[model samples]
Target: FIRLMAKPEKLGDLREPRAYLTTIANGLVSDHWRRQSVEQTYLDALTLYPTEHQPSEEQRALPIELLLQLNTLLQQMKPLIRSTFLLSQLDGLTYRQIADQLHVSERTVKSYMAQAMLHCLRLKNQTDN
Candidate 1:
């Protein structure tokens, strides 16, 4: 409602208000669930550390927030590019290995990585400003 009020132009002709409101409400609920899941996953990972090595509550918030932002960023990427980037970064797969898995050329994997890195860099720059 705050958003609609702030940008009343988005409200359009005010026709079918119920549908518009329902769409917005559904999106909010989905976002809430995604955030909760991310937070829980972060907390679960924290449990793997010894007590003294665990981050303070204040410190933990930053990584959890970063994870949420990273999740959103990845979701915006093209599926193939996302898979290639994740394979290399998360699964420790080499470009050749990713190429074979995806049945693409190593050059293609390199291109995808470049695109992913550029996307991340652009987002970082936007946040920095």
Candidate 2:
């Protein structure tokens, strides 16, 4: 239990150690399955491309990992910031367009985008370290 070792505080007030460990184990299993699903979806999409256009396995790993990291980051973000970031990055929407869609001002859209970018940079730095 690397997690338990790393965060020993989690065990501080445990009335049932078995239950606590089981919960952690269950969460790890769920996370494993979720990661597998994401990887599978990526691999499946790659199959639609011609063999000649396909990436090497080495190349594919990077995007899959990045996708997983991005997924985690988005999940941790505030809902409005997440929506704003997705609209601009994934949907190729302009700030004005996103602002209109979200019923916010253009300045507010810009602020949200800035916050999202800062969050991304912070995550990147953490991973790098």
The residue pairs found clashing in candidate 1 are: none
| Tens-digit lDDT track of model 1 for 30-122 | 889999999999899889999999999999989999999998899889999999999999999999999999999999999999999999999
What is the TM-score (0 to 1) of candidate 1? 0.82
What TM-score goes with each of the models?
0.82, 0.77
- Candidate 2 C-alpha lDDT tens digits along 56-116: 9899999999888877899789999999999999999999999999999999999999999
Total clashes, candidate 2?
0
